[model samples]
Target chain A: MNSSGVRSVARIVARDDGRGGTALPVLESDGPLALRRTRGSGAEARVMLVGAMSGPLGGDHFTVRARVEEGARLSVGSAAATIALPGQAKGEARYDVRLDVADHAELHWTPEQLISAKGSDLHVTTRVDLAPASRLLLREEQVLGRAGEEPGRLTSRLTVRVAERVVLDQELACGPGAPGGWDGPAVLAGHRTVGQLVVVRPEFGADPVTARVLGEGASVVPLAGPAALVTAVAPDALRLRRLLDEALTSLL
Target chain B: MSRAALLVLADGRFPAGGHAHSGGAEAAVKAGRISGAASLADFCRGRLHTAGLVAAGLAAAAALGTDPVALDRAADARTPSPALRLAARKLGRQLLRAARATWPSAELDALGREFPKGAHQPVVLGLAARAAGLGPVDAAYCAAYENVSGPATATVRLLSLDPFDATAVLARLAPEVDRVVDRAVEAARQAVDGGVDALPAASAPLLEIGAEAHAAWPVRLFAS
Candidate 1:
């Protein structure tokens, strides 16, 4: 219970009009977070998430929930990088996101990078529940610190379930001294930029090109639902971004 | 119920198919992250805290009678490497055979029937601990110990760095291993009530990445 924090919620539900068309009937949002409809082709309803607040300060708690109704499609992105700063209480910021995709629904979530400032402690968790025939693509990237400074402590966790069966669950922690040995080769290998992209579908298989895109500093892990979970880490943010672009392109 | 059963399961030569895998030490060694005993100690310590802690939590939860299928999915979520997942299921299958032959429990049989190819090795190990009447903490200790021991043994073979040095490396890690088991059992106790979400999801990114690379390797001493 950190005081002096901003609590925001973005609830979005995309509905299908039955003619292969998608509509956003519910975009109830509050606080410093807003969801704006964007242009997309076909049945895909694309939206951009804009943060009214400059960034998250220490002790800020942000919650987001988005649901795609049966046979509906929704694609989400952010307007800019999420800059996180330390708060007054614990000097930490927290983000909890929940996503649900109904039967035959599809969701594409590709957000901008998260830049953790010095002395900032951040925790982010995203949970997804997918019904049968549903699909979800989620990407999370983080830059440890601003230029010339050591990155603050951050922990990111992602949990995905298909039909109430967990398929992809991964957590990465980075800090001066934390659960993940930040300096050790077994964890980050002294890299500051870390990113993970998860794709859940019914017909997932080995993609050699995807494997090659995930080259040396990254990996492509296949989950139980024949889904693909790709993770990458690099000393440079731009380098990681290029690799992620290639990997995501292969998935397309 | 049987204190000796913990030792039996913890033994490296239990024929559980762990011998074929180096717990990522082979890759780390080849990557030059581990050249000597000190670096190997660091590698093993990191694995013990992250993957080791998470595995111990899952095993303890399974030993507490949590659903093996659910635990298997949780294990899958925690593991982000397909190659490592394959290795885990392979080890799980091998461990199931030994557990059924040794303990002969219906619970183990049900798990085998459910995951014919295999469950994650830690899930099977936890259930095997249950069938052997061991507690969650006992299972956690077994998992934590194996996490470090596997890498140490593998490093000894990979580097020819002297078996005695590797043995000393494990002895040095005994204290941390105990702490990991304690934390894992505590998490399992919470998971018994809060569900599998209460378990730890700590991970070692390089281990996952290295396993994927190692899987594509044309030749290697260990399977993962």
Candidate 2:
């Protein structure tokens, strides 16, 4: 089913609740954050952030900003993959995630995979600004199609800026007539799902053993003593999720 | 060709832009993971076994005019880290630019078109070797030499090691390079005989981590 023209945004704050469950921090936006429930209910949760909504959108001309204040530990989860339906004109999704963590503040921004349906094109930019002693564990996963189906042709680009420097830049173009691309044993290993996790911690070890353990199908590369890049590839979206979760658990 | 040409092409000072990279050594060093030459040598050997061997095998196949896209994909799949992929592409582009100007041919041009902006180094070098009339053994040797010498030279520059001592280290690595090349040539031959898909897959997780860490550094000189 084609779900188009649906747009909404929701912001959630994470605070230590003195108990195990996190408390929602106070949001300081000029307007209220947008939230909407789809007319039909299914096993999956589909959320869209559009213009006039509180969050980011695919077609907005201006950049959207998200602020995470100090001592706030926010965990943002998506109901499911957000699809970029074909736009009448070229469309783009831009997000500037400004995370202002106080000393020992933790943030986990794990969203669902971004699915670009057939004929859909999108460009997404996510920036994370972290303060010293702030910790962040973020994951970006993308699936080209739905279950039991070959992914439709699409073009998607993701650029992540951490502390004002480009840490991750990826562009995928897959269509019926696109030029030479990822159809080989070495590139994807015939895997359809891929995920990247970036962890910024001050206590990480300098040895290759820790990095090795963190990397499975992914490459574990060190970026100083406090940062690391972990990547993985799997046959499906679920496998990718499981692998990343395991890797992160092992790291902790 | 003279052995000097082999030395020149494989030399750390060839200006192919390899010396600038530690082949993931900088990250390892920054992480305090590698402290001495022996540990550094061990890191180099691991890289040789994983990235080096796979790349050399792919280069040999590309030299025989295999699809550049396929070879590039194979290399990319093996390289899971985006940092390493970018590094390989940067080095590949520079190497191809120089090789095309120095030695131009139809096959090289074809491979260049297939690669366009983001070909990996091993694939380009393999194609360049074929264009330059070099055989599989020579191509494999060049691949192994570039892999080891890049890091050795980087270690010298990063640590300020004596040039004479660096040369001696390179000298010591020559036999290892030959051994790797021999194994790679055999693998290439077997893959060609058995089919490309029949080629083996190997990996060294530690190097992958080093590459990832290097990419995340706030300030770093090396690309990978």
Q: Which of the numbered candidates is closest to the native, going by highest TM-score?
A: 1
The residue-by-residue lDDT of candidate 2 on A62-128, one tens digit each, is 2334444555455555554665444454344333334444455666667678665555445554556
The 10 consecutive residues of candidate 1 chain B with the worst lDDT sum are B76-85
Candidate DockQ values, in order, are: 0.59, 0.05
The digit string of per-residue lDDT tens for model 1 on A162-222 reads 8887877777778765653455767877778888888887766333223432667887666
Let me know the TM-score candidate 2 reaches against the reference structure. Answer: 0.50
Task: State candidate 1's TM-score.
Answer: 0.92
Please estimate how well model 2 matches the true structure, expressed as its whole-model Cα lDDT.
0.59
**Candidate 1 lDDT tens digits, B73-164:** 88888886778888999999999999999999999999999999999999999999999999888889989889989999998899998999
Candidate 2, residue B208: how far the Cα is off, in Å:
1.0
